[model samples]
Target: MADARAANERRVRRLEQMKTNGSAGAASGTLKAFWHGGRKPAHIVVRSALLKRVEGGNILTRLVLPRGVALRFYLLALFEAQCRLAVGGQWENVLPLSGPGSWSDMIASDGAYDGKSGTYMRGTRGGRAAEDLRLRQVQGALRTLEEVGGERPDQALVEVPRGPRGQRLYPSFRLLQESGRGSHQSPDIYTVPTDHWHPSRTVTIPAAFFLNGWVQVLSPSEVATWLALRVLSKWAPEKHQESGVFLYGDARKQQFGLRRDAWEDGCQRLLNFGLIRFARPMKDGDPAVPPTPNSWLMDFDQPEPRERYEPHRYQVIDEGLDQDAVRVCHRELTLRQHALDRRAAEVQSRKNGGPQQDVWPQWDGGEREMRFEEV
Candidate 1:
């Protein structure tokens, strides 16, 4: 375990070094200016309508359930590509043409141009296998996106049926329109409407998501979870507090169709990656255990402890990718693990007819002091 941790630390240090060194290059300098101006992180704007549940289900929910992290990434890439092109005017109707090279560039990796083959090749230690797998994933994701909208043409349009009394219906509302089948060589064209009626309702994705070595590390489910939380923050700004955004009830499941286990795992991983933190410790009352043998039991069997339903409040850390932030995240994760272990031990002890152990120590106020250094 210690070795693994050390290796991860070394990897992070290498990424930081690469970022520092690469900033001097002309291309990197250009990207740095366009992405974030070397200060605030660059952000991707996604239309809220894509996440909305129309008559034919939500596009994002469909992508989430199928474990479509790559697809989601592709969607983000499309938006990013469009945003870049929009600067040249024709922001609304123009469809940006993107190929594999454009898509792969969005992710941080070591790659070189193969002059002989006239293709860009990934420069990973895993060799050909890894490169092939990466290409396949990207291509597969593109195909899936095409199929998703292709099967239901009506999904791109909003239209109501004609009334029996000859009443007129409002004009159709178009959300997203796609053209041409995308491929590794020739990419597809996607158009998003920009009009007053269908105003742009967007969610801002932290630029670090693509630039800060996170895209390579975060799993598909983890990415989905992060995006879902961001969407929630935009949808219900009132729920935002200093502690974080409180996620309660079956809203995530009902709205996003994220399974309970998947959601939990995603959140756990995001926490581990230092991209997110729980606003508070999630503690619950112990379940009732079978009573031990007694004469007739004492006067008032302790009133059943009321079940506590503490919703998880999560704060997405946008900046502070320094070592201090990493250490704090590591400490919090360790504490959480210890608490889980203690809870399991207590449960087993009660089942074996042994005395329940004392409650684990709760998180202290010091966690509130957790801070990350802005890059």
Candidate 2:
């Protein structure tokens, strides 16, 4: 159905799956990422529909993730779990809530557990405690998805609202029955997007910083922005990781549906945490008005390290001709504005939770008539 769904996801997964499960000829197909440096880091399948929902502007209405990184991290664990289940072809293994069966009894993931019946719940988090903490946020997201899918919640949609420890619960993703052969089938199945498996759509995310405590406090948007950067990194890992790049193309903002302020704030956070630095692309051989990008590069590991990436160095040339140049000019202007906003955010963050600055001087000039400040 629609080749399993979602354009970007279909190709990447298909190629990788083909390489892993293909015939002798297909098995010989070598991917640079798979063979380069060392064996490629294993990936968790993230459904294209779901990724679009998280990052797409229109697909997901009534934004469910209101606060910070909880939603992002929850999705991380959920999708990882889905990837394993799909790969193993062990769909619908979660124990039903019938007599003599419980969540602890099912085989959840690739590993073995003592008290837990299955590897499913724990597999979602890859058996890491820090990653597992994010799973607590999954329940609310599930509720939101039910609304999006146009499904009304019936008693069968979920089980006990809370676990034994009073933690909000989510239905085990193991419920997706690909065969549809169970005595009682769930109307909703874990979605496996129709995969043409575009090889180019594959993204490689290194489990380094987050695993090592580098980005524990990121917000949801920050997480999304970081991921977008990670996707970009796939194009040139050495350049992206070494230089820490920017969203240089003017149209990429609209293409990715990123709100200006959110992206800038996310960049600032990454910079402050010593993970990245920003600067303008080196302008060299050019036609006078050399096209350059005001961008950020990773500041932490490199031949030369620096404390901050220089900003506000862009000087727009209004004399340029042609429509394309005009668009580039506008993007620079927008980036200039972003610099100012980021500085403002840094000052506000120091004050804790963006406190309003009392710039009215308490009694500016003839304030008896009216005050410009919030009352």
Candidate 3:
């Protein structure tokens, strides 16, 4: 354990050095300029089809990165590349004027900034670390996209650029070029005009998500939850708009492959972020009104309500991102996490028979009966 701890400390020190030095160089200025360009696009288009479940299941499940940052970065890059393709850019070629620095900078500027350190955080490390972590994450995402084909040769969504000798190239990258290769290929392939509307095939992520630092403030699960909610809101059935989309069953949750805890936690965070609101009328304490057909309260008076489940009617709030809201959500989540930890500890203590007693019952002759006394 001592050796392991020492090694970890060494690694951290190196990362800190990288962070300090990288920020002081010309590369840093270039990154900032590239990301903060006045002419940069205002919104990013994500292919919803990528989120859809295929035979191999959700692509997110295969991602090596812990947070949703990798997924976000991959989608952003894909959008840019597709736009290029739509405008008659060459397929199966290196992205024009694109390299590791710009790629990593885009993601870091959006998701890796550390408010406390006043520098971009690296990887899953909360404190200072090397900007190369973002590059590695980008590579990992691309690798995952390429390897998602698994045993099926034609299922890969990307074909990473390689040298003539099949050696890996550090800077060059390319999406799958063949017109009809991957069975699970994203609908984002360049075929028609990029500006054409395809409501069912795409989801537009507001530029505010990046510009307002929402990525830095929210967790991976929370980010995924918000995106999933957006997709649902877009596809929700007509007339259900008043109450929002129903997300009650395990089947519904499984569609996105998000575990129950993660999904619930994400929903709670989104609620705290003021990005979403639940519309359960019955739980509002109005006794006169009848519960909706989907409400769990409909069986409230029953002795046993078959199975218990929280009925959710999620409404995605379309509003500008707020810094105050993000700060409040962070504070609320921290407090709630502490409370949950305390409750878990208490339960564990009870299960372990906390504070075993040393006293035992002893007979008292004077009392003429068995009496309890300290042993």
Candidate 4:
């Protein structure tokens, strides 16, 4: 136990040294350059087919649409249909889907009025009409799934939970899994309620899939991130960090080579995604320190600011160059341009007979004799 404690202390000390030294090899060089230069780069924007139409519909509604439709347009249609069925002519009671804050407050509940299979909807134009319309939509969606996938369900009516505050009104359906897939390959569909559109309603179709012999429902963001990363993995940056940086310079002279810079780049990418935050260094000598390099121990599972996911927000620093070199070049250019501008301004002022401010005043550096009496 003592040996283990000593080893842990050594590791903590090493991390502190790396955090202070600011070496190029401290972490991944690619990530170091990215962090030092600027946090914004361009590659991180998510472009799932559903995300493309965020302005026209809420994220939940778009989840129900076919893969290619615009997210926003689908949402608008969903909301309109809900209004027509739930409370025709009562527009004031319906809500409007707006921002991320609204999305977070949404809930899904199973109400007594939750409909069953084969319920045809009828309504005029407001919240009640909207409720019935959404129910029909849910059934329609289920039927379409049958037509496309050709998987028949064992049951006629599956009761799905109503959305937050009583918005959703759809019966769910299930399709049998094909050969070679997991036992629960067929997932039951359910409607997710949201407060985005307010009193009227918006419902989402969610699928519960299996992983590791356990059933799990993937959120929209989770699914998008998985697919996006898969797409991005093919185009990973040319350079990555080597493992040696974590070992400190003790291994620098060793024959084995490690590209520690790559790890830093990964860190920067994660930071750009808002998955991790860079903590301001605390000078106090606390023995129980956090991991300094890569810092993978952070609470990365939490929701990050959506903007960080854009890959383009991180600047790519060429592995061969130093950040100081770029800053020097920029300063030199600015000085030269300022001198030229000053000269041009003086010339322009002379030509136009405009009020001019003298950039340089006459100067006499030599000592002068006391000859004021003669003058």
Candidate 3 local lDDT, 2-87, one digit each (tens) = 34234333323433433444432323344235445433544555655555555665555444245435555554554445434443
What is the C-alpha lDDT profile of model 1 across 1-375, one tens digit per residue? 334334334434434433433411322233334455322434555555555444455565555533333444455454444445442222222221122333333333323435577444445323454344435454455445545544664442222224578552222111133222323332323443332222125566655454443444444556667777776555445433344564333445545555666677677666665667776553344222222223111111445632334456787777633323223433554454455556667878998999977744555421221222110
The residue ranges of model 3 lying beyond 4 angstroms of the native Cα positions read 1-42, 64-69, 78-101, 109-129, 176-199, 216-220, 237-241, 248-255, 280-310, 324-329, 348-375
lDDT of each: 0.45, 0.34, 0.49, 0.26
Cα lDDT tens digits for candidate 2, 1-375: 122123213222323322232211211121111223322334334333332322223222223254323243333333333433444343443433211222211111112232355222344433343223223333444444433323223211222246789764555433332211123433544443333243134333333322222222234565566555654455345544444344533323433445666566556544433334453554443112211222222222334432332221121111221122112322332343444444455666767976565333342211111111110
Candidate 4 residue runs with Cα over 4 Å from true position: 1-125, 148-172, 175-375
lDDT (tens digit, per residue) of candidate 4 on 1-375: 234234333323323332333321211332223323442221221212222222222222223332321222222222322323332222221322322111101211111122364222233122344333334444454343333212323221122236678653432222211111122534432222222321112212211011010001122232333222222222222211110011221121121121233223333322332222333332244122112222211122333322121111122222212223222222333333344345567778988998887633331221111111000
Q: What count of clashes does model 2 give?
A: 24
lDDT ranking from best to worst? 3, 1, 2, 4
> How far does residue 62 in candidate 4 sit from its true spot (Å)?
14
> Candidate 2: which stretches are off by over 4 Å?
1-64, 68-70, 79-137, 148-200, 213-216, 236-244, 248-250, 286-375
Better of 1 and 2 by TM-score: 1
Q: What is the TM-score of each predicted model, taking all chains together?
A: 0.51, 0.40, 0.60, 0.19
Which regions of candidate 1 deviate over 4 angstroms?
1-41, 55-57, 65-69, 87-101, 105-133, 149-200, 236-238, 280-308, 320-375
